[model samples]
Target: MNMITMGIEEPWFKDPGVADMFGGKADVETIEGTNIVIRIDDEILDLVELTVARFHDDGEWVWDTPDAYGWTRNINGAKEAAMKHGWSEALLRLREVVPSEVVSVLDNIARMAAAAVRN
Candidate 1:
């Protein structure tokens, strides 16, 4: 599904609420021209939470860091660490609360990824 199908939007990705949790706010946008919302689903929200955290903490996403090798490494490390936590631990919990819907969403994504790899 596209981003709107998964509940993703510009504002959500650069969330003030999420930033405030980390002691700041964020503002993500499109690369050029008008902005658009892609996914509108639980998975998008989960991913947005991760993204917002990175942007808020880093203070230099695409805007400030054009040649972001460090940003790449940071996200890579974070993705690895989150993976080390496993899907259940990494994805299902929002604010330390586990939700079955999140698990179901992640399971679907895992299956899709596995199938793509197998193919």
Candidate 2:
């Protein structure tokens, strides 16, 4: 499985208060702009695992942990997805299974992914 690890060490992005929301070990060194790192690994990473597990059981769990960036990353990704394959029926089905907020972001991400693939 492809494993990706993204981390951010920005002042606002890694704000202690926000970092605490996600849970322990969500903090990175405070800096200016956030940093995101995605890489393939020997095993699936936590983010992918959480998404898959929650998706399978239709669970509702907010990501309290601080990502490299703030909430905007989520929105940006979703929008990118929407610009891609035009949000297919199957993708929508999977997306709908998640919470509305998350779905919104993912819907956009789907478009982004599709567009990236096309390119």
Candidate 3:
């Protein structure tokens, strides 16, 4: 299983209010920048990775699971599947701890990454 751990070096994380929002959920390193770590399961991670790789390679966007074997061409559908799998309970917890604007920023970042993989 792979663990997704991200270090947020954004200046906004230094704010006391912002740090407080995370409470005990995230590890606030210091006033310089805070590191927020969100862990997710391997299946979702693998799906996202595969989706991005296919998108970058301009290959068919189909999730070829272990139990399935077929070349089904569905770029939009694949992208949607990738996006849906990318979302998790950790994101919901992140939303609860961070401001709406911060959440929006994170969401946008996630979407951008997912878009890059999808395209």
The top-ranked prediction according to TM-score is 1
Q: Give TM-scores for every candidate, taking all chains together and pairing residue i with residue i.
A: 0.25, 0.19, 0.23
lDDT of 3 at 22: 31
Off by over 4 Å in 3: 1-50, 53-60, 63-72, 89-119
Candidate 2's C-alpha runs over 4 A off are 1-98
Candidates' RMSD to native: 13.7, 18.0, 22.3
Whole-model alpha-carbon lDDT for candidate 2:
0.32
Residue-level lDDT of model 3, residues 17-107, one tens digit each, is 4344333332233212222234343222222121211222334433322222222356455434444443443355545544654566788
lDDT of 2 at 83: 25
Give the clash count for each candidate: 13, 15, 0
- Candidate 1's C-alpha lDDT? 0.36
**Model 2 C-alpha lDDT per residue in residues 52-114, reported as the tens digit of each score:** 001112222223222111222343342333223222322343344435545567788999999
Model 3 clash pairs? Answer: none
Candidate-wise lDDT, in order: 0.36, 0.32, 0.37
Ordered by TM-score, highest first, the candidates read 1, 3, 2
